[model samples]
Target: MAALRTKIIACPTVGEELRSLLPDGFVLEMLAYGLHNVPENLHAQLQASIDATGPEFGTILLGYGLCANAILGLNSRRFRLVIPRADDCITLFLGSRREYLRQLSLAPGTFFLTKGWIECGEDPYTEYCALRTRYGHEKAHKITRRYIQNYTRLALIDSGSYESEAYRKYARMVADYFDLTFEEIPGSNELLGKLLSGEWDKGFAVIPPGQVVARDLFYGPEGMP
Candidate 1:
């Protein structure tokens, strides 16, 4: 049999994490962040990337969660699309849906941060600053406040792979600036590792050839693939 041809098309956050773990011969493509605001455009771009991969890779592994159904109705005619059963990238970073759920239950009002998210400069503070710059201080302050009113805590996920004093300090500073309860949480690469290792379980939604990815796949087997 030929080698398992695989490509990981992921959000930049998880894509950067995978860069350190994936072995030789894997095609890795990291898409731009900030597309969360435009789901339709993001989905189109994602599908374009998938289709652009051509027939060289037999499998396309997505480094994303449900992500507001960004991948809903995506057609995977060229190769099978395997995605982790997650609501968002937080689940992938935390290692499992259960852990994410626990965090969710513990802190319903949370702003999750990671090294990637921090380095990307797309946090709420950044948005606030951009808004302040473009829309003036008063308007920016009003909108930014309303934008993040629901979040009371900021939890930084320290994956232990890319820990740096600089990022941690920024995280703390953001917490202070936002007046949020700051906490540090451990992150795991177990899920992403298994994803690159071709270890498919019920936690993964494997869309075979000839079938487009449905919204239900994001919910796992119980939700249907």
Candidate 2:
């Protein structure tokens, strides 16, 4: 009999990107975006998804970064859990933990955007539009301002995972609305490819069956995770 395909549990943003890159056959589960805002709930939902998929696949490939440590304590008794050594989607988008940090150091107050975020309608511009509908323009503007107090730049990352000019335009509009400088950064799928290829080197945390994901496992220096 052929081996069963792996199951993928991913953040919706990155999950969308994975569609084109993942092999022809696999089970995919995409959790909603912005779960980073509610780290605890994100953890619970992911743990639940893992449990649900455990019996179905021998391996579960998590298309997520360290993700605020949300995957930290998840146990896998019936399957292996594999995740990239990244703090969040930004690292996944930017290619590696080093590049993500390089951008942060170069512009600490940047709001990063990706094709996945735009295609999924999870950008701040989407939130702003919804707020405008619910709270009216003035109130929405105020709220948006308060929400973006620390951010000074809006960066759209194209990781060569997907391409869309409309997404680029929308991100530019967001920059104009917020009076933040807009920048375009090239993204890479190097690490993302590694994740799918099961190249579980130090760049990935490969939790064997019957073990749990620990914070420390995701906490090492990006080079030797």
Candidate 3:
């Protein structure tokens, strides 16, 4: 028997709340590191955390495109990245709703708001690749290889073939990043059905790693807003 470990990341506001709802006996942490961009110190801290945690699985849950770049480059073998079925573009765009909407002129109805949240409109993998490119292809490839080595699996939850073009782009990116092994779990209607079918030992969901239940922790009266 092995211990289950997971990393649940969400909006800066919701990380604490999500941590509270997690099951006991599993090592859990929130991705709340603050820095404008990838910094050496932050990377070292991340390395230290990985070494200290020593969990068999690492799951990432937020969609702001902030940690994806860093997470893919971590030097660990038990890492897994999970994103909600909604397109990453929505998450990226909404990182700064006012600015994103003003620049892109995105209508609120884009992608029908998966799980009742805005989309960021970027491919997780492509963006990751871009980050790698910034560092240099060889370095990026090396880091990505390391990331894959540690990454047990990558999955996309709350996804379905019946999504908008934007969401489809997200699906494609997840596939490309993990070589298309991403699973499309229904977010609204048949979420439970999909979870019951999968056998993820150390699962991670963007909203609720391996679950299609997307809750708003950053907005509304109860949300952070």
Candidate 4:
């Protein structure tokens, strides 16, 4: 039998991590990080990408989580779709939904950061800086505080895909700027590795062709199973 042809569609926030483990010949498409700001737009772009994928590929591996229901209705037209069983990219970084929940239990108000997030300027610190440019320091500070008022800690997830010194420095700065505690946590590529290697196990949702993604695939009706 011929080897299966696979492609990867991923959010930019988790692109670097996925790329680090991607096998040769597998095509990877990194969508805009900004799409995350609106789940509807993200859903549309993802569906469009999936729809445009050629029929030659046997499988599409999505490097995404439920993502605020963005994947809720994504359809797999002619190929199987594999998605991580996670709430968001944070679970991808932390390696599993269990670890993500454990960390959340420790600090429900914690904010997570990764190399991709820092490089993309997707964190609150970047927003604060941008706002400061438009509204000056005092006003920007107030607004930024209001935005992240519930966050008590800033965590940098080190997935070991790359060196962390620089990203850690930035995370620390952000935490200090916001008067939040800063901590470095170990991250795992285990989930991404499993996804890339076809270890679909219970950690993933393997959707058949012609099927639309449903919330129950990632979580039960009440929430995470």
Candidate 5:
């Protein structure tokens, strides 16, 4: 049988990483970063994008994780869907589920940041600034504190896809402002490289046409419903 024609539909949150390693000939479509704020909306947008994709493409690569179960129940009547087996994009940045789990174990209260996140202005710090503009500084500080009360650290994942000086400065400022420990973690593009190279292996979920994405695909036999 002939190889399938593949296209990638990804969240803009990982746009830089994807572009850095993307192979030739594959078209990449990046959705808006704001969709992640609402899982339901993200799910709806993904399903719509899949359903509306041209039939010329036989497979669609989703550059997303379970994403708060946003990808769950997504189905394509005309194409196969390929997704990374990750709880979130942070796993992709870290390069594997094991690494992501390890980081979680080390710092369960960490709030992770990446270049894309900083560039998109979606982090808590950005929200705090916006709130400070409308509300007073004291109120914004209280609100921001409430939002990150449980977070004890701010971890910036350095993927090396781009320079980190400016982003690092911003992350540190946010960390200092919130009185959280600041740390920079080395990131990898191994999993993303594999995804773009069709190295499905056990790290990816390759859903067949008409099949819905399920928790088990990402979490294995012991997956929770």
Candidate 6:
């Protein structure tokens, strides 16, 4: 028998850059019904649907009003295309950095992309630390290192951290791989929070408008949202 291809379809968040990133083979559509609050009752239904559907790609959608706390039942693979409205900084970088970078680069943009401080402002290295905490620092850093190798250029702004000197030193290693620039500023978290939450109201988060604002939206030092 031939190897099975992954099934890829689930709840969608309406509008977001990631929608554009969906592969040609995958199907994109809204959930069977609107999720008022991550629908606790739907966990079994979702799991059953995913299991019965036997999706090779197994993606689940996250709609507006669905809080992360609502559905703590989901594992990493509950949906291949899991779209959590509010995810931990570290969780975003769970995959290999090189692979993630390649995936990100292949997505549909070339201009400068920015993730607001709401996601990275927690502790400056909140995402990095989250990754390390969840997957270990060495592993997370290794992944970052690998991804850095593939990119020919990188420009970083360390405005999120109060410890500018430390960020500057770390920027050197990243700079060794790609051209890097570090800016020291405080309150990146606050800046990002406002931007994504529509306080600034002129950002990517507003594209697929109508969803809970994140305290912090995690991605990378100089990466996509």
Highest lDDT scorer: 4
Count the clashes in each prediction: 0, 1, 15, 0, 0, 19
RMSD each, Å: 1.9, 2.0, 17.3, 1.6, 2.1, 17.1
- Each model's lDDT comes to 0.85, 0.82, 0.39, 0.90, 0.89, 0.36
Clashes of 1: 0
Model 3, residue 74: C-alpha shift (Å): 1.7
lDDT of 6 by residue, 131-220 (tens): 777788788767655544444433333333233455455544444433433322221233223322234221222212223323333233
Candidate 6 local Cα displacement, residue 118, angstroms: 24
Minimal lDDT window, size 10, model 4: 216-225
Better candidate by lDDT, 4 or 5: 4
TM-score between candidate 5 and the true structure: 0.94
Query: Residue 213 in model 3: shift from native, Å?
Result: 26
Window of ten residues with lowest summed lDDT in model 5: 216-225
Residue 221 C-alpha lDDT in model 4:
51
Residue runs of model 3 more than 4 Å from their true location after superposition: 7-14, 31-33, 37-39, 55-68, 78-104, 107-225
**Can you write out model 5's per-residue Cα lDDT over 1-225, one digit (the tens) per residue?**
655577899988776799978877777989888898899999999999998888678889999988899999999988989898888899999998888889989999999999988989967889899999999899998999999999998999999988899999999999998999999999999989999998888788888988889877877774421
Q: Model 6 compared with the native: what TM-score?
A: 0.28
Q: Which ranges of candidate 5 are over 4 A from the true structure?
A: 1-4, 222-225
* Candidate 1 residue lDDT tens string, 1-225: 676588999888898889899979998988888787798878988989988886668999999887888888887777888988888899999999889889989999989999899878867888888999889988987898898899998999988887557877888898898788989999999889989998988778888988988876665446522
TM-scores of the models, in the order given: 0.93, 0.91, 0.32, 0.96, 0.94, 0.28
> What TM-score does candidate 4 reach?
0.96
For residues 1-225, write the lDDT of model 4, one tens digit per residue: 667689999988788888878899899999999898899999999999998998679999999988888999899769899998888989989988889999999999999999999999988989988999999999998999999999999999998889999999999999998999999999999889999999888888888999988888766653453
Two-way lDDT contest, 4 vs 6, winner: 4
What would the per-residue lDDT of candidate 3 be over residues 27-82, giving only the tens digit for each residue? 44544434314545444555556555445555533332323333334443455444
lDDT of 5: 0.89
Compare candidates 2 and 3 on TM-score and give the better one.
Answer: 2
